[model samples]
Target: MKLLRLVLPGLTMIAVTYGLARFSFGLLLPDIKESLGMSEAVSGIISSLFYFAYCVMIVLSTVITTREGPRRMILLAGASAFLGLLVMAVTPNVWVLAVGVFLAGASTGLASPPYGAAISLWMSRAEQGKGNTWINSGTSFGIALSGAGAILLSPYWRVTYGIYAVLALLALLWNFRVIPRAEKRWKVTFEKGNLSLKGIKGANSLITASLILGISTAAFWTFSRSFIEIAGDYRSWELSGFWVVIGIFGVLGGFSGSLIEKYGLAFAYKLGSLSIASASILISIAPEKWLVSFASAGLFGGAYIFLTGVLLVWGIRVFIKNASLGIGIPFLLLAVGQVIGSSLAGLFIGAWGYAPAFILYGFIGIAAVFIGPKKNKAED
Candidate 1:
């Protein structure tokens, strides 16, 4: 029961940081672009800036959470998210919007590492993996909430964001009350920096795979809703429903820890990555087919979260000495690849078209499955 209590706040934290702060940008991109008088390429650049900030903060989070011990930084994550969304809600121009994007992006990075440390400190070995992954599934929860909001709010994007900001503020309060404060030394001392990741087996394979997966998923997150809206000529409610299906099904990914215990971790990773790639192809080619498009969203949402869970476990195994380092390294690299992918994908789409870009990214996701660890590995 106590363990369950700890997990809830972490879950809410992820929901706010990833779902509201980061992913909502994609969901609301059409409204935002129209209101700001921005082009797709510019939207892509802003999205890339979000990932760039994410990559940077996730790296810094590794060090800060190590020294600060999660609580303060977790507060920072929530605060940044709330303030970021508030700014985005009120922003009158593109430049101010970018500032909000960067801060909101950073919130996800800040939210991630602390929760792992918190769970590690609170949960038993039997509970740790499940708790962590369930919290990770909060991304889906946030998505669901945002989707519901979009449906109800309709054409009011700014009003939608303002509500999201209130959600973040509530999340902040809940987490502040729940997560324990750091010890005296935890506040003052810096984590001892080794500046080395020597002798970690399969490190290369893990990072390579993360970067590959990141690049592949970038286009989907950045443009899926807008693409669907354009390609299928979907109504606002239809798009909202599509987003909700993804979120509802994505909740299943929380069980990935159990899946790993039943099947091998490597098998789970391959299956999830493959499913994600297939999702892009399925929807991209058949946008006019309502059933196929919805199914694709559902598949991609579940697979994306499941794959991320796999990466979280994989990272911790490779860097067992520090939970923050483990989570940060894989996620940070993934964001780096996203920064690259997000920066360029709009150009590709503009030059060719959306379907071709999705097909291209889907193939890249397929390629990710083969970048497996070189050695025969035991299940973690």
Candidate 2:
């Protein structure tokens, strides 16, 4: 019961911020483009705004949450989501839509770090990893919900976004009721010379791997549905179903902490990286085939969330002193990678097309495997 209060709202907040607010842009891009007369290149540039906003807010949230406690930051995140979704619902032009995307993306950045801190503050140490991963999986739930909305509201994207805004508001209200006021503020002092590279293990590998994975996954998150719709000439239901499959399979990622507890982070990291990379290559092979596309979506969803879960644990362990920083660092770098990858993906798809672009990203993921955490003998 104690854990339920935090985890439930935690998950929902993440779902609203990440799934609906951030990734859903890709799922709905084709329609949005048709409505706004936007090109793929322009769409990609706008999508990059999501990450840029996220990057700024996450850094600020990490610092603020550390000093002020999680309550205000969490509420701020919810508020951002609500406003962003509302803006998106009414957006008439590309500029207004970009503002909405920026705000929505900012919500995700505000959402993540504080939750990490909240888990550290509220849950027992033993329960922190499980709680964090469960909350992280909320992205899958939000994605699935958005996919369902797409099915029911096909070609009525404005209505779909309006409904999502109401949902975000509801989530915000729920969190406001549940989240407690600030307790003890965490103290972080760089001037004390307490933080150093030698003290934090795995920081380098974690940041590098996260950035690479971010770049590798950006093509999919930003353009996979478009690929399927255009390349496969999939119907509305089929495309929506593909997005749903990704979310449903992504729930499997919630178990990543357990996987690490049993098989260790090294194993989880390697397996997840390979699986996600394979997903990109797999879809490229036969996106026109429904089975292949859905399978690839499932694989990507599961693997992407799973890898993030692994990173959450890895980041927490690396920055054991500051849990918010633990969550902030890897995620911040991931957004940085997305910022770069989103832009490059647009150009690549424009120049070389989807297949070659996706294949190239897959190779990037493969390269990430070499830079992963060293296998711990004790955990192995």
- Per-residue lDDT tens digits for candidate 1, residues 271-378, read 888999999999887887789889999999999888888888777667655667778888888887776776578889999999999999999999999985432464
Q: What is the C-alpha lDDT of each candidate?
A: 0.83, 0.87
What is candidate 2's lDDT per residue for 247-305, written digit by digit as tens? 99999999998898888889899999999999999999998999999999999999999
Q: Enumerate residue pairs that collide in model 1.
A: none
Worst 10 residues of 1 by lDDT: 184-193
Model 1 stretches with alpha carbons more than 4 Å out: 39-42, 184-195, 373-379
How much lDDT does candidate 2 score? Answer: 0.87
**TM-score, cand. 1 vs. native:** 0.91
